[model samples]
Target: MSLKKLISIFFLISNFIFALEIQPTMFEQRIDGSGGYREFIVSNNTNSTLRYKLTIFPGSKKDRDMSKWTEVSPKILTIKPGRNGIFKIFVQTPKEISDGEYDYTLSLKTMDLPKLPGETDKIASAAKLNFDFRLNFIGYAGDLNPDIDFINPVVSTNANGKTVISGTIVNKTPKRGIYCAVNVISGENSLNYSEIRVPVNGEKQFSVTLEPNVKKSDITGITIRNLENSDIILKKPI
Candidate 1:
């Protein structure tokens, strides 16, 4: 199909919104009551004027809303064609807050333009588009590290007639959630690989299928690697 359609499909699968390009879609750092801030840029690539708005939503419980301690300056912005706008994010931890991880979803939406008069009667109207640009915000309270453990793992054939390895991976730390990658090995070769996220003090189910060329009997085990440093978190033998 068209190149634009292909890009849209890829972005949809990756859970990303294609809009005015923004740098640093994720923010993760150590925060305290003293307050800290970060600055990012919004690049306008189109010929028309770009107007974007940012909103922070709670990703946790009502009592754990992180929006209370966070501030995004100039939430609404307008940039000329082919220009960039900079915005700063400031956050502060409360003294009464417990030592742990906090997170929120920051969404960016492009404002719609007003409809022109007498345009639709003679010609097709321009489609008004709205994009949900989600930015992940993660803040850590105190000293913390990622600790992921593989529970029980087993191999079996899935309904699609493919060799599947399934099990549970738990985050043993009370610090914060972690993004990790897992490599499934068979004998001396890597059969499959995938990325996963484990919530703080929570567990997530993982199911990965081996390559078609893999021999099931030679399956060795799995290795969990840190996405940031690529450190071997754990090696589980089955």
Candidate 2:
């Protein structure tokens, strides 16, 4: 191979080798009338030390800001080779605050690692490649009163010959959000369909497919229940 080609390949390999790894890419926390906190684990898998900066931002486009209620500890973290570090996130809800669901994105970005003396310019530039990891954080506050309704559920078949149910989940409550599983019952066969989260006073469209052997005519009812509390939010005949 040509010398130039070898150098390009070397830089590409180095960039891939230094990427960061994080655990629990997505997490949810419930802050009732009282406040609560959560933690995430970040590991340094590269050969050299790793430095990262943690920041919080609104997770959804509709969310304007979350800094007032959400807090992250140790914004800057350093981990030795093969070592792990922890990032703690805390959410505080005042008593006057309304009950609802809030979303935030916890982002960890790698700082530029120092280059060794006498390193080639090309290698140094490649080593400057930084990696970013983001975790979707969902926070719920106040009394947990989630009202979910299944609307206009229809059964169909997908290209894979699996039974599919399509519909919308409406959260009627003005201050509560719900994350739950949709269960479709057909006589003696009960199939757990899709799991979804509907924000406060919002509705979300969902489609879930069952096994090929599950027939559309066999589906008799659909029920939605809270995953955490197993509370039945809505049930309807299909």
TM-score of each: 0.61, 0.61
Q: Model 1: residues >4 Å from true position, as ranges?
A: 1-29, 33-51, 57-59, 68-97, 113-137, 159-161, 186-190, 227-230
The TM-score obtained by model 1 is 0.61
Model 2: what TM-score?
A: 0.61
lDDT of 2 by residue, 144-168 (tens): 6667788888899988888888888
Scored by lDDT, the top model is: 2
Candidate 2: residue pairs that collide = none
How much lDDT does candidate 2 score?
A: 0.72
lDDT of 1 by residue, 29-57 (tens): 55666765677899865445556787777
Where in model 2 is the C-alpha error above 4 Å?
A: 1-32, 39-51, 57-65, 73-86, 101-103, 112-127, 133-138, 183-193, 217-238
The candidate 2 region of ten consecutive residues with least summed lDDT is 118-127
